[model samples]
Target: MRLFIQLLGRFGVRLDGEEVPSIAWKRDRAAALIKLLAVSPQHRIHREQIMEAFWPDQDVELAGANLRKAIHFARRAMGTQDLITVTREIVAFADEVQLETDMERFEAAATQALRSGDPAECEAAADLYGGILLPDDRFLEWLDAPRERLQQLYAAVLRKGRLWRRLIALDPTDEEAQRALMQAALDAGNRGEAIRQFDQLRERLHAELGVGPSKASIELYERALALSGAEPASPAERIRASLAWALVHLQSGEFDKAAELARETRAQALGGGLAREVGEAGAVLGLTAHMQGRWPELFRSEFTEWVRSRDEFVPSVFDGHLCLAEFCLCDAKGHAAIARSAQELMCVAEDADSVAGRALAGLILGEIARCAGDLEEAETHLNEAERLHAGANALSGRVLVLERLAEIALARGQKWQASRLVQRALGDATQSWLSNHLLLRLQALAVRAATTPEKVEEAILTGDRLLTPGACQPCSMGLRIASAVALTQAGEMEQVDRRLNEAERIAGMWQGGPWAAALWEARGIQRQAQSNKVRALAAFAEAAARYEDLGRPLDQSRCLERMAAVMPAAGA
Candidate 1:
């Protein structure tokens, strides 16, 4: 007979290919006994050791009796009395019974991998280490040492494999691993990644230990800066590097970091009397503000600066235009503003021949056309954006373009095509690490596109995971609305109400935006589901008006249709 025990993550036992029932192991001591035996050297231990662990307080006679009972239960659970044997003071698995365990497998693989120094072998070992051994038994004293040992082995395997990201995930405070990763980034000429690594290490150390990075780390940081042509370089090079770092932080949603870098860069540029560098840093700060929803602040300063430099063909000028265009497209009574800003963005993008800039410009133009209910124009621009993003191998940009196209397809009742697009966007989003905003947007869309009960439930759960506290405000609001709609379709009225209520609470902070419109639309759906025709119609009408005010004709029309569906019968 062959006995296979799984001691990692969760505990389980299988005889051959069939799992033993949980009922068989219902006795806690029985399961614990098996765990102790499996982890022991050669699956054997002294009877006194087992009794001492299981019943340290009991007299020797009673403890031995309890151990016998536990042994009996464990053997019965394994479906063979021959597997476990007792001889005088020793307890062991029978010599004839072959026993295999996940712990042994992981250790064997890790040992061989470490000895050979093979990446593939290391990965295999890492995969075998499911999690800390017997996580459910975390409080058990006997498990602690083994758990720590296995965890250390896992970390060593990751480091030996040069899987720096995975190693960082394993222990963010591992300075040696972080330094290796930073050096690797520098070696690969990824100055932005090197800087990001250093910043993460420094911030983590500061937050957790009330200290900063070590001197070696500080020296490497200086090397990274020197390599990126920062301070002590030519003024122009220094300013450019600072702006580049700011943009990197912005792209990764590190707004505070981006702001700090941009402010420092702006001050240095001003000191050097560098107009272009100052504008570039200011544009980055403005864009960061826009991303964080500081709309009024962005418009007050960045707006004026963009207007003054609208004729420039610099990438930062195009970024300024893109930021303004996106805001205008989302705000009420800004159709003409959006058109103008998008036009300027496109002009700068074309002049500079920047594929990414053109892709972004095309995407915003597509969003504008889509909101205006011009499906044909929207599809044309979106298709161009998708092509550009694809040609440039820009995964995040392509995912955004696909999401817009999917929305258009869903509006046109092409559920199959829309589903396909959403799935593709989700798959690509997973591979794009710095696309949290994009991921949230795609998750919300998935919730909206779900039709069947299973799909709707999955979408709701995914939305819940994505909409954590301190998430991006606009995207999280959108996800809540989408989840509300999905819950409504699932006929989960209570959950739907909760989702809408939470959305309303979030929307309360912002006076006027697309979020307000979406909340009204969701409320209409909820009221319609509850068969409150008058309230539903009222809600949909308000939603339609809000959408129209925001220049979103397509959304307005959708709300109007809902209003019609809930309007009181003519005779009544």
Candidate 2:
């Protein structure tokens, strides 16, 4: 009898290679009891201890009965009493029951990798221990010991090497932890983070330890500075090092670098026959492509391929489902089909116990509804996504939800609400490239609410600052449209024409898509302002056609209305 427990995403217990779904869904006590036993070092646990641990508030006899029921349910779920045998002396997991626990596997793998001097393996192993142990079972005494151990171990690993930055991110004041991270940053040649960590540690040590950093820490800092003297060393030291680098780059608005690193990481993982690594790399690549306005490439390279691939690999199946939903949201080629695809993706994501995945799926569903002109459905899904993000403390997810809400408000002509929502989004954009890009688009919408030329000019300047030359085409097009619109409102007809022409030229060089439709719509406005009714009509028609093709019925209708108003006789 082999007992397998996976707490990677949500939680699950399996016996003999078969997952016990009912234990996960219907019996909380059984699930909790199994988790407690699996995490315990002593496979044998006393019945008194179980009763006291779980039901300290209740009568001893009642607690004992409840424990028995839970044990019975657990045995039923396991489908064999051979795995868990009970005696009056004590209850113990059978030795024949070889337990496979993620926590144990992760710790063993990380320790072995560190001992063997395999940084990539160590990093991968560390990533497996993403959250602290039994994060959801915090109140249970049985879970506390293992959770603390895992937390300390994770902190130690972070301090030793920056395999997982999120550990330090939770508690920056841990000096010993900071020291470990400093060493890791130095080892990886990330001069910026290394220096940053050194300074932080110096301050923390002075405040907490009443002394400078340790000799070993100072030596590492000095070495890092020396290495950074001529040129910054490679961003990362190992193959799996790219994950940390990708996060850094993603936060720094270096989408191209993030995409390139993700691609390299995927190729390396595929070469190494690491299916999970390949899937993670592919997901990162797909996300980078989507953020960089390369949705077509994302769908073709990752989303389509993963969905068609075999499900023997868990990571591939999970990533494939997530990518499918994201692709459905962005791909403009088939709205109905993509919407159905997103629904299916949601089911898979839920099955995987992926909170982030489900939140993202809901967001994509909202986007699909928004594109199809179903603002009510869009709002429902967006609200659900927002709720999930809040529950999970997912900053990126919240940003996405807010941006979509702002777009919906703008489409509905709720200018004041749109402006307020966009302002909130701007405040929350932080350092993420996607958030910043969304902020710029929201600012463009807010410009419509500007009552004065000065305010319009301010919005234009804000939009201009966001359209840095290497930024995503979608973001650039948004800024161009906003600038053109603001200039037109300010009675700067000549400047409007110039900006519109530039936007048109850029859009022409790019392939036709939803982004291009925005640029063309801006050009249509400029033509209408110039009294070139024929060209204005043509431009609006083209913009509408593109929007319709992208499944954005609301935008298409807006373009059609503009064209109809301009060419009343034509009645487009």
Candidate 3:
């Protein structure tokens, strides 16, 4: 097309490779008329709407006269009456004009790039963004939506291309871009760059808005500092940093990487004779292993020794790590050995007066009690755990403790309280300074506590986030089961079956315990939803038996009640 209009950056018109000087138009409305047409769908707008946009306060007859004069000036300025099409009700560019606009070109490029999902195409499209549409027309109300839409599309292209620096260039105060750039820097081992990016963003945000960076941003900055070893430090400090990085990996569901890093850190700590580092590394490794359904081999010998001589260890060392592993261990199988170890860990925490250790120990004890159908004891232990965890600000521990407390509340038929507890835990889990594993687990708890349709739908949507590959296996399985139960309640039989199938697949790796019992219960719920009373009763019976064997009278009773509900009253 020989006729081209520029709406981005600067506004101008070019015909036959020659610029149309602004002096050609005696009236400014002539140019505005073309711009309005260019931005409208199919380059067309009704004459009445055009008049309202330009001269809203004028009478209809007067606006019509003004519109005709503007059209005359526009055709005169463009040096072609053929380019302006005026109908009885609509004004548009003529069919033979063969006109083009930067806005149209940009939309085409953006559409192609987004549809292709190719980074190179995205980068090309991002480059074409140039600037916002019609900068000179910044004050025009009609330009606002189009300008914002183009800017958003430009940002999306930059994001799809992973052009973080370019995105930051477009908007320096863009925290999302800043965060992305900072992460990219850290991933590339450019710690200084990462820190500098955060500092600049923080300074700019504070100076401009008189507010701090978001919680997510601040937490990420802290993590970068902790994991980057940004400051000169002793070997112990570096070891601690390594442990922090491992913890991040653990939280992100990279269990194998976390385990490997923890092992390396453990070796270093052992070489340096750093007992505290060694213990913490073991804790990291133990937690990763437990999440992955591995037997937590790191705790076998050293942990036993620590349990044997509580004074030989730092009480804080056992606070969340080892205690959490033992809690998970107890969950996997309520074995006497696991319970004894938890007890021993609790004793050590008490003797050392370690609040974190005590809190974690109480969490484990609470889980054991809850599993054994002792809701009263579980609530007492979990409440203590929650208080201590909150005081210490141990987020993961607090989440676990609150989850158990919620479960206990649910067992006692307090769905509202259970939901409140779950929501409280979810609120604190807003950051991933640790693995988002805890967050996924909390979402599953929400599904269980959901009583209303809206709540159930919201919980199910959040629960779907847990079905990702490489999620913590135990949490993933638990979420699927919980989701199945919720889906059954919602009368979504197809979704319930899909969830159950997925849970069954996950259970192939390791099954039994409350997970197995929960799976069976979920199946029972699904069968009952299908009105398959025989299958539902059988499934509930199996679940009740499993719960009975695990010493969970409450769960067994629930399952038994379900079985009774589904059982045939008499011969038909």
| Winning model by lDDT | 1
Q: Single out the weakest 10-residue window by summed lDDT for candidate 3.
A: 311-320
Best by TM-score: 3
Task: Give the range where candidate 2 is weakest over 10 consecutive residues by summed lDDT.
Answer: 317-326
User: Quick one: how many clashes does candidate 1 have?
Assistant: 0
CA lDDT for candidate 3: 0.73
In candidate 3, which residue pairs get closer than 3 Å at backbone N, Cα or C atoms, i.e. clash?
251-435, 319-357
The digit string of per-residue lDDT tens for model 2 on 191-288 reads 76876786666544332322335555666665665673546433222343454455457656788897788778876766666765565566566656
In candidate 2, how many Å is residue 219 off?
A: 23
Candidate 2 off by > 4 Å: 1-284, 287-331, 431-436, 449-452, 568-572
Global lDDT for candidate 2?
Answer: 0.65
Question: What TM-score quantifies how close candidate 1 is to the native fold?
Answer: 0.53
Residue-wise C-alpha lDDT for candidate 3, range 384-423, written one tens digit per residue = 9899887766676687788888888887889899899987
lDDT accuracy of residue 267 in candidate 1: 76
Ranking by lDDT: 1, 3, 2
What local distance difference test score does each model get? 0.74, 0.65, 0.73
Order candidates by TM-score, high to low: 3, 1, 2
Q: Residue-wise lDDT of candidate 1 within 1-572, one digit each (tens)?
A: 78899998788898877899888987778888889989988889999999877776568999889898999988888778888899878888888878999999999999999999999999989999876688655435677688889988999999899877788777666788889988998998887777788778754553233234666676676688788443354676556556656765776778999889988997787678765566557666766776787744454344334333432222233333332433334354666676667677677667766666667668878887887889999899999999987776667668878988998988898877888998888776787532455678788877777777778777767666555344655557777888788777666554566567777886785556688888888888888877777888888999999998888888899899877766655226
